[model samples]
Target: MKRLLYIITIAIFTVLIQNSCSKDFLEVESADKLYVDEYYNSESRIFEALVAAYDPLQWFDYAWGQYTHIGLVSDVMADDVYVGGADANDCIYLHRMFNYEALPTSVVSDLWTTFYSGVNRSNIVMQYMDNVQGISDDTKALYLAEAKVLRSFYYTWLWKLWGNIPYYETNLTYPYIADQNTADEVYQGIITTLEDAINNGGLPMKAGSGREGRVSLAMAYMLYAEVVMYQNDDSRLNQALKYMEEIIKSGQYDLVSNFAGLWEESGEWSQESIFEINYFSRNAVRSWSSPTTDGGSVYPKFIGIYNLAGSPDYDGGWGFEPVRADAYALYDDNDQRRDGGILNFAKYAEQTGATYQARYQDQGYFLKKYMARKDGNANHSADADLNYNNNFRVYRYAETLLNAAELIARGASGTGTAQSYLDKVRTRAGLNAISPSVENIIKERRLEFLGEGKRYWDLIRSGYAPTYLIPDGLYRTSTWTTSKKYLPIPQSEIDASAGTLTQNNY
Candidate 1:
């Protein structure tokens, strides 16, 4: 009864649903593709369109056979992880990316495709909403709000990494060209879309009950704060801080006591979660032939131990991201995150007699957060690796608290003092409370958000990239420079755009 909604499914459904949802509001009757004009005449159809806007975020390059999580590339590009796989051919691009050596030809094109697919679908929904029937003004407002927020979320990724991307509010036609917008322009566009969504006043402070997977007002706020901070927009610092405070004051979210528990199967959508891209495997149908179909994530399989026989603790995997020993040593022994967040495969193998082949650049460590587990991909035919049930927790309460504390430390006014906000997260993680100085918050975020893919950006925005990202001989031979901020635009996109898409000056 699990249905995975997706972008490629769009060709099969004009509005978006083809057993695409399991139940409740997301459930819709499957049909052959219809024209855009023929669909969206009812409230139900319009809802389908809105859901389509969210579907692309779930896609992770199953079709293309690459780890294309928005966070995946960012994490690989960071300094802490080694691109561990069978060899370079299996993960060369990732190794190159981490080394700041990825060419435009070798770019992870799916990152570009997935988010833009979302952007286009979101725009299509709003365009069709104008003519949709059988929905009240209130419902119309709500759907529009959702569409705009989703659109902004998608664009935020493009703006941050790609920079100077083809930006648009409406789906393009004919030549299918969009204006090449600078990062600054994209920022303006995202802010405008988010502001409009907020003014629509149709979203809830938090998603609850049946709306577990949908975006909420607070999620938008978190994203708004994320965008503002990364951009270092001085004017919006106070506004972003206010949004973080609103989530904190709402009492809808709090840190779960167990830091290690955050990665468990039970932790998928816990109290700490603000937003997550959901994946399901109980009835997974997606396979190599139909990569576009609904199924669980292939990400866990990619990061799992390569060439290892199955053990009581975990299944054998391709082993793509071996944690560096230096990064692993950052956690104090008393910190639950060390024991819980990361797994020392060497230590575990010694203690439990579990065996695994050491992957390339093996540091004897693995990210326990998203590793494959026994029964993790159950119900998928034979190919369980492509259907892990790990949902991507995009935003969490801990991040919200930390965001607030960081802002307060930077002198933004807030509901609570910066120290109190910082302490809540630190104390929860079995550490003594410390001053919320910018330096401490920075280190705290490094430990707290590691491998979740905030580190590279954190280093960049905090002006730590130039200094901290020195040319390490192994993975980072090329020191990070200002020009390397944006990834090179995929050459395929440039070819498709003909003259519209220009390559980034990487």
Candidate 2:
């Protein structure tokens, strides 16, 4: 019998069955017979349930390129990295995003749904672990550790996107309601979860071959470090620094020689990656907003050239998100990453058969990071259905180094050590070295983590808010001090919570 756990509410119970020789052994059980106690009694059932916990990570828009879009567009609109085009309704929101006026329903929906779904899945796995039998105690501990780490991940996203959210632990099976928790409460919960995972030695220091995609001790430490950095709690800085130092001293990870190789399809499980989201080409599904019936590919759709013979029809809907003239100008001509990271809009148009008509005449560039395709789809077909199975790199060794440098710069009593950390990243980018000044460290972060969905959080952690540009492009101003830093809780979630949860003040 397949034991199933009902997770809709908070109550937890079990069901039993009786069999007789005269009766059919295959007699079906009542649907209501399914309960948590009955299901969690075996190891295999628990393991399968844990596997289901990982599903929410791949939600379209919220996870992949769309995740990058929210941060990049917001940053680019504020600075000179990119500009809005005629058809760039989304970019318009980006430009004015800091203003409470421009918050879009799509952004709100994506943020809320992605993180809550992640939280719910993690809760389910944690709720029923004791019932899993036959597994060694150590193995069960390890699985629990992974669940805690994953829960921290979801909380991290929630902390960054919503600032304050309702914190729920234990599986809620009855659709009970709860009020919102403060930002500090949310941060503490994330820290607690990560610390428990780390102290328990639940995650392996190094990933085993069969556990390639699983979170490890190194990842847990790194995530803890990130949370501490964001919280900006002075007392936690040393702890954050300690976590980073441990990862570095462990010697399990290294920086890849070539930055481009980091994203190359061939580099999926490279040593430099501490943690990354796995996306297989064979199982690729189109993002929810994609217009095509056939699920589209994320990479080719975002980075492929505009028009090339035998190339897939990328809706050419909007031209590639070009490198902003300002961001482009920030780099020296010799910087390899400038060209390596960005694809010129004009160059892309010539390579792909798709036309590169600018939606907004003034804002003309599209992104070029993941543009290459194994093969182009047929015309008018789903061009996004290309064989680009690039895994999204979430945590990398390079980031660990950067995190250390940032911590050291923020008043860590280090003697000339911070500069070396910052230099390593600059050296990799083929740029001149920078001193340990806070501004320089921030600039290095901005340059190194471009288009990776780190900028918005970086700004918030650094106590900087999104600066808005007027429609006429006359002046740039910062409006992030308002409630804009934390996105509003989704209207749908608010409705679901009824009067139990209060909406964030916009």
Best by TM-score: 1
Clashes of each: 0, 30
- Give the TM-scores of the predictions, in the order they appear: 0.92, 0.81
Give lDDT tens digits, candidate 2, residues 1-506: 10111122223456555656646567777777666657666776777666656655545333532433343434553443443434446534444453335443444456566667778877877787776768898988888888888878877877776777888777555676666899999998889888888988467777877566677888888889888888888988887888787888887887777886666666656778888766544433433454212222354455333433443523332333444656666667777666666655555557664444444433444444455445333232323443244456678888888888888888765333787887878888887776878767777777777666676677766765444233334323444554666666667677788777666675
lDDT of 1 by residue, 1-506 (tens): 22234433343345553453546456544466576687677887877788778877767545556678766678877777877887766767777788787888787877788888889889978998878877899999989999899999989888888989988998899888777988999999999889889878489998766577787999999989988898898888899999999999999999999987788778877889898887778777767776656678888888888777637877778888888888889988888878687888778877778888887888889988888878888877535667888787789899999999999998888678889899998888889988889889989998998778888889988988888777776656778889989989988888888787778989
Worst 10 residues of 1 by lDDT: 1-10
For each candidate in turn, give its C-alpha RMSD to the true structure in angstroms: 6.4, 6.6
lDDT of each: 0.82, 0.63
Which whole-number lDDT from 0 to 100 does residue 341 have in model 1?
A: 76
What are the clashing pairs of model 1? none
Cα TM-score of candidate 1: 0.92
Tell how far residue 67 is off in model 2, in angstroms. Answer: 8.0
Model 2 weakest 10-residue run by lDDT? 1-10
